[model samples]
Structures are given as C-alpha cells and as structure tokens.
Target: MLSNFLPFLYGISVFVLLILAAKIMLNGFVSSQASLKTQNSFSKKKKDDRTGLVTVHPELLNKDGCITDEDLLTVRFAKDSDHPQSSENPSE
Candidate 1:
C-alpha cells in the first residue's frame, strides 16, 4: 500500500510543478508583449514628428515642372533620403 501511495504522491507533485511553470511563462510573455507595444508606440510617435516635411525629387523641378498626383504620392522626408549629409552625426 505504501509503495502505491508514493507513486501517486509523486504524480501530484509533478502536475503542480508543471502548472506553476506554465503560469510563470505566461506572465513573462504578457509583460514582454506590453513592453513591446509601448516601444512600438514611441517609435511611431517619432516617425509622425518627421512626417511634417515632404520633399520631392530634384529632377521633378525641371520642365513639366508641375507636380502631378503621382509625384505627390512619391514625396518623402529629406532627412530620410540617401544623401550623405543626412547620415552625418549632428554632434560632429
């Protein structure tokens, strides 16, 4: 009888440990997701600040100088371009 009870007690302890481990993992996932959401919101807000400036391709300045709907669609921020000056550190 004692031998049978030992196996039963072991199984119950193992089950409780598994449940505790799952709870710990779930809590960690929830906190990390919340932190990730906060980080994404911060980055989105920074991007919104830069969107106030819209620059067009310099070649578009020449004849057929008029900006069309398609040209407007292609406009982007000057600081976001591939220019060397845009990549330079402000502190330098």
Candidate 2:
C-alpha cells in the first residue's frame, strides 16, 4: 500500500511545481521584460554626432550626466588600390 501511494504523491508534487513555474513565467518574474526594455532603449539611444555616427559610451559620461567633450581619434586605413604598386608584382 505504501509503494502504491508513493507514485500518487510524486504526481501531485510534480503538478504543483508545474503550476508554480507557469505562474512565475506569466507574471514576468524572470526579468525578461526588463532586459527587452534595455535593448529597446539602446536602439533609441542618441548619438554624439548629427550624422548618426559615433555612439557615446556610458563610461564617457561625466558626473553631471553629460558626455565629456574630448577629441575623437581617427585612423585612415590605406586600401590596397591606394598603396603604391611594386614593379615585381605584375598589375593584372
């Protein structure tokens, strides 16, 4: 009789756990909504330039809640075509 009652007890416990899991998920207790909000906020974030370039990082912000003014460093990459061709390398 005890052995037969064990399966029934297990089934009831499993059903209770499933119900709790469903309730937690439906109530958004896993913070999925908060993460989605942060992702959407980044998409709507303002850039430092009017050309829509140069995303200002959060670390660059000053204590006054503004982006600190600093010179932006840029490097011009030399394309292969822009490089001087050597005579040894036959130009196709």
Candidate 3:
C-alpha cells in the first residue's frame, strides 16, 4: 500500500512545482512587457524642454506657476549645499 502511494505523491509534487514555476515565469514576463511598453511609449513621445518629472516636484514653481529669483537661489543652494551647518557660531 505504501509503494502504490509513492508514485501519486511524486506526481502531485511535480505538478505543484511546475505550477509555481509557471506562475513565476508569467509574472516576470508580464512585468517585463509592461516596462518595455512604458519605455517605448516614453521614447516615442516628445518631452517638454522646460519641464520634467524632477522639475515638477521642486519648490521653484510659484503661485503663478513662474520661477522667481528666490526660488532659483533656494533650489540651487538646497540641492548643492555641501556644508549645510556652519562651523562658526553666530554668537561668536
């Protein structure tokens, strides 16, 4: 009786492994296809010269949607300031 159950258990284990492998492969293929589609679409489209994903999130845009001098200075300093905290004390 134990010998007869061996083949059935083996077959079930193989089937389950195959199912898991297929699921993983299908998920990978779907994600890759989606990424490819996005890349192709982005490549084909013309991006605005003045605006981008990085630019949009910045604090430069004013209430009127214009770049002011304060905004420009703030952005440049905030992003590229190497030494943010000064070694000198203000009370000194």
Candidate 4:
C-alpha cells in the first residue's frame, strides 16, 4: 500500500507546484496589464495650459455642486420605515 501511494503522492505534488507556478505567472501578467491600463488612462487626459492644473470631476454632488465629502455629509437620512432590511445573510 505504501509503495502504491508513493507515485500518486509524487504526481500530486508535481501537479500542485505546476498550478502554483501558473497562478504566479497569471497574476504577474494581470498586474502588468492593469498598470499599463492605468498609465494609458492618465496619459489620455489633455493637459491644461492656463495653469498646468490637473482636475478630476466629482461624480456625486448636491444642486450647488460643491466638490467635497463634507458637502455629502450635510444630507439627512430618512426615518426607520425608509431603511430596508435584507432577507439574505451576508456572512454566508
């Protein structure tokens, strides 16, 4: 039984190593691709000549259009009836 298990164990260990190497290679490729994408996105933004200013437009705001997190905190949440409870368990 011991002799029979040795070859199977060796094969499984080799397979596991191969899988780990593949995962590392795939992760490196993905990381490099993501970095390149980020670089391309930044490069595409047209540089402002007036003051050499780089500005990012805010995605969320009120009617006044103040670009700040403090502006968002000013808004009030509704009563207990407005808050809905989920039926599904999040931990699972």
User: Backbone clashes in each candidate structure, one number apiece?
Assistant: 0, 0, 0, 0
Worst 10 residues of 3 by lDDT: 68-77
Off by over 4 Å in 4: 46-92
lDDT computed for candidate 3: 0.76
Q: For residues 1-92, what per-residue lDDT tens digits would candidate 4 score against the true structure?
A: 99999999999999999999999999999999999998787778754544587554666554578654542323346754555444446776
Which residue pairs show collisions in model 1?
none
lDDT of 1 at 57: 68
Candidate 4, poorest ten consecutive residues by summed lDDT? 67-76
Q: After superposition, how far is residue 50 of candidate 4 from its true place, in Å?
A: 14
lDDT of 4 at 68: 46
Output the number of the TM-score-best candidate. Answer: 1
> What are the Cα lDDT values of the candidates?
0.77, 0.77, 0.76, 0.74
RMSD of each: 16.1, 11.1, 8.2, 15.5
- Model 4's C-alpha root-mean-square deviation from the true structure amounts to 15.5
| Candidate 3 positional error at 32, Å | 1.0
Q: Which stretches of candidate 3 lie over 4 Å from their true place?
A: 46-92
User: Model 4 — TM-score against the truth?
Assistant: 0.46
Error of 4 at 8 (Å): 0.7
TM-scores for all predictions: 0.48, 0.36, 0.48, 0.46
* Candidate 1 error regions (>4 Å): 47-92
Model 1 lDDT tens row, 1-92: 99999999999999999999999999999999999999998887786545577767676565677654342333567778564343335985
Q: What would the per-residue lDDT of candidate 2 be over residues 9-37, giving only the tens digit for each residue?
A: 99999999999999989888558888898
Error of 4 at 23 (Å): 1.1
